[model samples]
Target chain A: MSTDRLRDVLRNSTEHVDMVELTDAALKQSRQITVRRATVGATLAVVLLAGGVFGAANFWPKTPGDGVNVADSGSPSASAPVEPGPSTAEGGGEVTVPPRIDGAFLYVTENNGLISWKPGSSPKTLIADHKGGEDMIFETANVSPDGRSVAYNTTSGKLRLRDLATGKARDLMDVYEGNFCGTPAWTPDGRILITPNTEGKSGLFNPVTNKYTELSFTVNGCQPRVVKQGGVLMVYFIDGSVSHLRGIELESGKVVVDVPNTAGSRRATDMSAAMVTADGKVRFTMRTTTLNGTLGDGLRGFGGDSLFELRDGKLVDLDFDDRTMGAAYQGGDGLMVLRQKIDGKYEVSIWDMHQGGGFDTEDEPASLKDALPLGYTY
Target chain B: MPDIAAEFTEFARTHTPSLLRAAFLITGDQHLAEDLVQTALARTHRAWRRIEEGNAPAYTRKIMYHQQISWWRRRKVNEQLSETIADTPSRGDSAEDVALQLTVRKALLQLSKTQRAVVILRFFEDRDVAETAEILGCAQGTVKTHTFRALGHLRKALPELADAMKGNV
Candidate 1:
């Protein structure tokens, strides 16, 4: 596909597929066991059996290195299938880049407490730990979009809004098993936090009055991803360089964005961020050898691929360099540019938006504001 | 065992899509798909303990698939246009892609329920044979057979998509 063509397709490929009727039916199917005093014990016993699985794995579908097997149900790749390989479950990701280096990475605690690394000149000081051993991580701990105010999940599994200001915490919902790690999200209003599985169906829990308003839908869950465009909660996963963008509104739990990979007849769902031009061209950030060396080694053959379906009658490939892109999110504004070192010093360059996007030797950001070349931070 | 409302809310927030995806794939109609996903999710919510204990996506998918297959048992399931994506106009590099997707979807609807399940799981979910088998609770060879036949049926249904397979990544 041509570059312009890919951008056009990505820009316009929108189809809303609502499955709410299924929600109603699914809700009817669930037999809600009321958690009263006598049954709470039995309920806990049940939760211990189920919820305990969550504790067993903090992040499933993490990555190759993150050393933890939340579940072994994942079938080995036919490309390479093994029931269980060595537990190469290291931290599991190439997130060793910047933004992360300076930021106090947000992680969920077992009992829902947000830990922050307040900036200090000394060796990374742990300035703020909510000291929340009382609640489960799923309920209490939530990080803000701007990365402030850590909400508290309780031991009994309730979501509490904790004000970073005066150190006061209040119960947002007493009836919820709301947990942050469980992908709890705050609505755009922040007045109500959205959760699923209430009213014998999926519903929203109000923080102010501690009540849950039953939504007509009866399903639970979304991956809890956010889009910069509409501060609403949604899900977007990239496959190779092309991204499969799906936006969901937490309000009615509707999927607003469902752009099928119409660019050619391809769908490589192995998505990662490379540099993208503001125009919506997605590129690759890392350079990796194929599992079978399909593309061979080091530059050449039939490599670069960027597929996009335009609204017009044509599908095109966006132009890009593949020498620099491999498989990691470089950096970007509209174009995902990255800072790579040249001759012992770092320089900012345009990253390839191809399937295995590469780095562009040309195109320098105007110097004065572009000290980024010297490695300000990735 | 947690507060019913709270447990329900949390559950709803996360698992709804899995249900819908399974349903939509099974019954080509978006409305019916929504019903299937909702019905399966609600039932799962009822037995939250068992649902929670067992694998979630699989449990929900099983419920949804079975519900959809037995649609004749009760026609309470609505088959109509839904309000969710009503305004979403299709914009692809080519109108052909949208046409292709719709065509593929229609073709999928023509297959047997299990055959449809095999295709959706294998290609859409990108699962290998064993995982698709596990999700379907069938023997690995059954999954392979289903997938092979499903592909053949798809190729027969949409020769254009069949021709494009060589370019698939």
Candidate 2:
């Protein structure tokens, strides 16, 4: 038939399809997929770091006063490690990290609950009832420095912690009245949880006494991570448009490091920012608009922002390979997770700054095999 | 930033019917057509911020086309063919019109996935050969070849429409 006739036929054929119902279902699916992607991003970061230090002796040097002890060089005995079986929960499975990676436990938040897995042990669900929904808070939950407790907020705005040893969950406090609380950051001492409220304010909740302390500072967008040097680095929209990274001292509530004030750029986008603190340093990704009042071509499309590190009080370009997409998160003991987009697939790797190493710099690329092919569990 | 949910709701309300039509032509099943539109819209929702405002419908269309091909490729073996056409008569459509529509859909099921996609994008969607090639991530020549082959198959399957096909070709 004529093309117009065919178009008319096709268009009229869908008269019975309910657009409203389809859109509603699509919206729910979209939100779930976004959450799943965020969880996958965090899980991949941890797995990349775990794979990086797996098995070689003297890979990580323990530093004094560092809170998160990811590895003790002499801890894993000379005995052969046990191989863990498959995961028992639905949509959960065991990912085999290389046998050489000793004492590395990867904690992933899947649809069923928070799961913890070692190199060879079967994946075990730490909390069984953790159902992910629209109200589920936290992009990436914090595993305490001692690795004893996992802290996250539920969809109902209640901050809860699950004891890894007992699989028992304890309600810490009601964080807010809604579903979208930003991820909480744990202090170096693991004594307090810094939770971000949807409305520009942050609260420090002491799990010991179940008390909440409100911070005087306000963040316009995105959550903040606590730096090792007793400062909180947050990305906030200054004047509602320009994104700025300001470091505030936890005790005095004073802005210690305002990169935008020193660097002289006011074009950052609020939502297009991510920050990670490792080795007493901060690395962040920010999207900036050009002088022509349009987003730069580099930051216009998907995954198109460059990572910058605050070094010597200046924002220095990490200058990773053009293929490197962005930085994800910083692991304990100076490991930074970076994602490299090669041929449209994201490959996660760990960058070590303490080894005089930087992305696409003097550091050798970590050799990691593709593990955890569970494929977007949520 | 605009409220993403509200913006998406408005966009979907305006475009969902058209998208469902395109998806119906692609999938050749009513239930599967609704699913295809929902999946495409869901993907578009995730990238709504990155996609320019006027490009939402085009973005969703692209996702629908790619997702249909991917699904066909993954489940080609298990796809059950409907032996009979299940056509719901539209208002003002006579028995002959409904029969012709069912015939066209049946002929569509006979074409290869790529050939069917090229036909839908080029003819029904009115995308030029270059635009079809760009959407399908193929060379313009490939789109031309697919369109030619697909039309030839349609003409043979529905001889009654051969005159119209000849006029369009």
Candidate number with greatest DockQ: 2
Candidate 2 wrongly placed segments (more than 4 Å): A1-12, A15-20, A38-378, B71-78, B87-92, B167-169
RMSD per candidate (Å) reads 26.4, 20.2
Estimate, for each residue in A149-259, the C-alpha lDDT of model 2 and write its tens digit.
667666677777766666666777676645343556655434556776545377676554455677776543334455444233332222232434566766556776765
lDDT of 1: 0.39
Please report the candidate that would top TM-score against the real structure: 2
TM-score of 2: 0.42
Report the interface RMSD that candidate 1 achieves against the true structure, in angstroms.
15.5
TM-score of each: 0.31, 0.42
CAPRI tier of model 2: incorrect
- Give, for candidate 1 chain A, the lowest lDDT window spanning 10 residues: A369-378
In terms of lDDT, the poorest run of 10 residues in model 2 chain B is B71-80
Q: How well is candidate 1 docked (DockQ)?
A: 0.10
Let me know the TM-score candidate 1 reaches against the reference structure: 0.31
Q: Candidate 2, what DockQ?
A: 0.16
Error of 1 at A339 (Å): 61
Task: List the global CA lDDT of all models.
Answer: 0.39, 0.52
